[model samples]
Target: MKLGLKIKTAREEKGLTQNDLVKISGVSRASLQLYEADKGNITLDNLEKIANALDYEVVHFLSSNVVPQSKKTCPPICPSIEKNMSPNMSLNNICEFIENDSPLPPTQSNNSVRIPVYDEVYASAGQGFINDEHITQHIELDKGFLRSYFGLTSFLDLSIITARGDSMLPAVPENCQIIVQKGTPREGQICVTRIDDELYVKRLQKRPKYKLISDNKSYDDIELEGENYEILGIVVGLFQKIP
Candidate 1:
């Protein structure tokens, strides 16, 4: 469920009205309504207050899939993630427990993270691909390698998607796997962006006005001076088949 729906469900289950929650949690009624409706960007502080008021942990609303216990008993990586012997924690839980915490046990077999692969979603190099939620599989990457090579702070910030077409040509060839990270996009950074529900992989440039620049000049640049756009992520790495 979405964050707003989760909050609304929790509130209804607790039999607390909006006014009651506002009084108890000290969150404004308008803010609470917006949160329950899933409309605005909710802050961590607000979420915590509402969670505490609803008599639940923040994790309860963060992930639908709870951490499952491993059949084999293994040493705990950290105190926060001891509920499961193996790394069976949900994506949200893993991020919650691991971000800025001590590194996990240095066993080669265990020192890895799983990044979701959008098999059906392509960030087009020539044209735009319609964005979707169809995740076909996950790619496992070495945690230390990501941290050292890409300077990644959280595993949750990564995603793997396919790059289609030769518009990005020399730098990002067609049919290559792109490793993108969630961050503030800067000028001239190659990023995945969405406009009118279409996804595109292009380098951002500000030539007095913002635009999406294609490496292959044969393709036309997308002007974003007045068009609404969303920066999905910045391209950090790529994996191409050696054929």
Candidate 2:
């Protein structure tokens, strides 16, 4: 049963009217009505208030069978390519080979395959060839190798792109290439953001309100609310090509 329905059922079983529950819970009457009608779209704080008022634990209103979405798994590295890799091979060279060569299908093995690096392509942040943007680089490595090399087992999908704008300077200078990963941004995590069609890379802060911070004190933090902003991705790594 949905949480709303469960809450309504429990309240009915306790022989409490919505108004009585509101009085006990200190929750607004409209909120109590919403709860009983199974339309409880409330925040965690409000939910706690309702639970306290009902004389029931918060867990009692939740479905026991709820399962979270599984984390996406990385494709296996190709053994055929692994055999040819030399100890002296740099990350750039491996990327080149993966982009240039065609190998076995991903379903055949647990080996690494190259993930194509396409240009800008309207990524939710970072810099790249905008619309007709071309591929500037291709990174190839087994997921295991990348995890070991970066010392980050929690890394998700990684995409290479150049940084744009002076908004996130000093810490992440313009033109610096970055590797972005798909995941939730923790407080203080540097992330790429999409705010009303504009992109920015900034330090993220999540309070009752969201804020985008910059290392340069001159730049003010951008507060985000409603549907105007979203976190595109977290920056996991950076690289700079030498001439």
Candidate 3:
């Protein structure tokens, strides 16, 4: 059965309604409905939340038997674990596997890719100070997830940078790390832009005139009519510690 069906079956067996699941799982009602209907690409974090809410082992949800229908070939978050998962593995085993950040097994290491995390700062809601680019670390991510989710042939164009300020507000919160895919910005997409000496993370707008928009209304939209600016890249993903 599909992962969604498995979740739905487990929820039903628990004698809880969708609303109950929402309250217990802390997952939005809309997302729960989407997962049940198999219309969404549920993230690993959200999947873990749902599994915990139902008091079920997360491996049970991630097993090959319950593969998500959206991406059949794409392995779940950690290929190191998913590739070796067994029906008998407990949740504690999964945790232990994660705490030890060893390289993927020799056979699967080739399937992993490293994306750099830069120490440069960019303002999501305010003016960003320009600094020399320095790579702080490298994070390993599944090659398939990058290709399938971001539609990128290679991981060289991707970099992670820290976002600061509240101008972007709830969308890109202060201190959050943003994954930027180096490329041209599309209209209405959140992008990293450099104007003169300052850097910014804002939504790109090109309809009436070239502008950078902030989600927070208190921050004024930047008109780029005659500014010396360059579109660094678009914000493709965000990484933050789960509260």
Best by lDDT: 3
User: What residue pairs clash in candidate 3, if any at all?
Assistant: 125-167, 125-168
Of models 2 and 3, which has the larger lDDT?
3
Q: For candidate 1, write residues 189-235 as lDDT tens digits.
A: 88987664456779999777889988888888889977767777888
Worst 10 residues of 3 by lDDT: 83-92
- The 0-to-1 C-alpha lDDT of every candidate, in the order given, reads 0.61, 0.53, 0.62
Task: State in Å the error of residue 222, model 3.
Answer: 0.3
| Every model's TM-score | 0.49, 0.47, 0.52
Tens-digit per-residue lDDT, 153-202, candidate 2 = 65345665556556666667555556677678999888877665455678
lDDT of 3 by residue, 115-174 (tens): 554543332333332223444334556565556655667566777665666778788876
Q: List the residue pairs that clash in candidate 2.
A: 76-110, 76-111, 76-112, 77-111, 77-112, 78-111, 78-112, 120-129
Q: How far out, in Å, is residue 20 in model 3?
A: 22
TM-score of 1: 0.49
Which stretches of candidate 3 lie above 4 Å from their native place?
Answer: 1-42, 47-110, 120-133, 147-154
